[model samples]
Target: MSTLTHMKPRALNLLLLLSTLPVFAQKPIIGIFESTSSGAGDNQGQPGVRVLFYQSGRQWRSYNAICQDEACLKTIVHLYPPVTTWTLFKQGKPVAKVAATTPTAYHSYSEIGVQTITNPAAVLHLERRSTPDYPDRPHAILATNLSHLTDPDNWQPAAVFPLDLTHVIQAFHKLYPHPKNCTQNTTNSPSNYHDSTYPDSQIKMDSSYLSNKTNWRMLQITLGGYLCDGPPDDAYVDHWFAISPTGEVHHLGRLMHLAGAADFAREGHSELLFQVQGGNEAGYKLFYDNFTHQAQDTVTYH
Candidate 1:
């Protein structure tokens, strides 16, 4: 009876050892080539590239290589274990080779350039191109030179005045009954130009203008003397108009204004210190009022 008890315990230990043996004996399956294609001509379209991927435990590994012909096949064979390697058969014969490094391990995959892969698990593809006229694409357009303004950061839509066209025209007519003609040049030609008798004040109007495919009924308001030699105490004003395709014109006023004083002595000549402020309707109104007051004060005092 005692001998039987000792034998039972020994038998249980032997069974446990046998159960754990399979876990370590299990080999990783490796070097499985997932995809391969034939070599086409000089290899532009198809030069023989194979992509492979495999899993070991929880981690994944991949490899990419140029497989031109049989020589490439031999190279792959050297990398993978011989007995477990499986040749990727295209049609009836082996086009490429694959093998498991161990019992369940798989090889890895990778590639260069844009390529697409589709399988039950996922689909991925990529394309490369360029866009030129994209609005957000950086470009510069100048208030004076659109081409120079090609730098996106520097370009701004032309400014408008604070007062609308109807109001601005009325104001100008009241201030200067006889409007003067503008110089015949690219920007001002065919448009009426007027200069204030006082060097510090001036106003000009352009009846026809076009921008961003829309015709503009335009106005130019200049305050402060061009000949003042230094910055003006007041600001300058700009106004814009947009005419629709139906010949309907709308006044978009007070586009921009420049203000503040210049340091004349520091730079030898009086330099205009200017600030560009506002694009919205309220902004235009504030700028127009500021410039108008400055111009009126200068006219009255000088």
Candidate 2:
């Protein structure tokens, strides 16, 4: 038998009473230290200390202990080599057995059993629950397969092509078969030829009132060459036309350039003729100044 020392009288009495409990009827008496690391100079600290209760092959026990030293704290936790049984007392009687085992030698503890659940539907539901919707919303245009241009549900008929003075004149001539040579009387040489008083006056004319000198109503046609040859994806060329009141049309001119506008308005006439090409076929308004014989302003198709 191992002799016990320094046993307090009260502790002995309590131990005797615990021995008489029903718990000791089935197993041998086991001793346990309620606290460890209490000795002098053992700066083993409280961090590595733990209280454990468990059972042996046939008895219950409990104890508290600290890791060997400060340096071995991490190693002791990793190794967990110590495992002990526990004793339980109820009303001063032993009543149950508590068993524990340390799979790791440094950190003494019993292995905990964990059950993994894998249900496809449940997992998918959980994933969907965790996912967000507002931030990940789909694009409106991407929701449908049909393009906005072709989709009848959202289709809108575009307005008819806008018509300008030049186009109106052309259309009028095309519709109403105007005589090629209209008869009209002409004066040989007007006294004030440059005077604004004779605004609509006509000069020398041939047998047919149509002056052979120069018809200011003549329309000029021009084709703009390739501005760029690539797929026209991001690039475009501006095709411009300048028509003078004298019926002389100049093509491939930049309508926006002041020089081009000057060239078109230098000739005194009733109207300034111009056209734009590239984006869409639309008519544009041309403003003319009778006094300056120049185009004052223009309103283009959007």
Candidate 3:
């Protein structure tokens, strides 16, 4: 092992690549993430998700350095690009691991092209487009054509949890009571991002189990609507929870926007992948081991 040294460019690159092994000796499964909507609702062949993060052993690698501005965005297309296979997971199961292909890279975000998808119900020959929301703070996408993919198996999928929003709403009011106000975000200047008038703010909740053999929930909540005012600074709100089958509730986060639940270690359970948005910094955090043992935490922002 070499002590951290100011080595030449090529030497540094070699050292970093070698660093991926040794801890687990196993290659860390590329924890790729998407926005989790397949845009299949319209059957337009339009993917709703954008490649938000490509996690390889706690690091976002190039994206962490490039997401802050546009000038670096050009480098996305210039780099040799990542050429690796990716598996699409739906509700804690592998749907398919398409053969390795470079996803079409645009300026803002990347997606698995329709060419990669076969025998679709319907396809929309969509034009090349980019959105400010994706590259919001990070003005870039992977240069490769292997788009990080997530397809909702069915348009109206069955719920994973037996409990509903009413359960959470009761918990929220009892535990964290606040002055009644329309603003869902208390950290920003333009705090209000939803259309809720006051008493009834929009409550969005997503439920999934953290294990292959459970009906519990890895619950994600957003307190307000994001459609009206574009996107706020802190979008993934802090209301993340885990509700056990017998109805015990546990708080799982301070601030995060979930990418998806995955068994990255292939250990039969799930680890949460999230885009962490806090007051001072923003990056990705992989929260694991909540069900197996005591809940532990790890953050990879570099």
lDDT of candidate 2 over 50-130, digit per residue (tens): 222222332223222222223332222222223334333322233333332322222211111100111122222211121
Query: Which stretches of model 3 miss by more than 4 angstroms?
Result: 1-24, 33-129, 133-157, 160-164, 179-212, 224-238, 254-257, 277-280, 291-302
Candidates in order, TM-scores: namely 0.18, 0.15, 0.43
Q: Output the number of the lDDT-best candidate.
A: 3
Whole-model lDDT per candidate: 0.27, 0.24, 0.41
Total backbone collisions, model 1: 47
Candidates sorted on lDDT, descending: 3, 1, 2
lDDT value, residue 59 of candidate 1: 30
| Between candidates 1 and 2, the TM-score winner | 1
Q: Compared with the true structure, what per-residue lDDT tens digits does model 1 show for residues 142-222?
A: 011001111111112445543444455555445545333333322333343445343322555533322322222234455
- RMSD (Å) per prediction: 30.9, 43.4, 10.2
Model 2, C-alpha of 4: deviation from truth (Å): 99
Ranking by TM-score, best first? 3, 1, 2
Per-candidate clash tally:
47, 22, 8
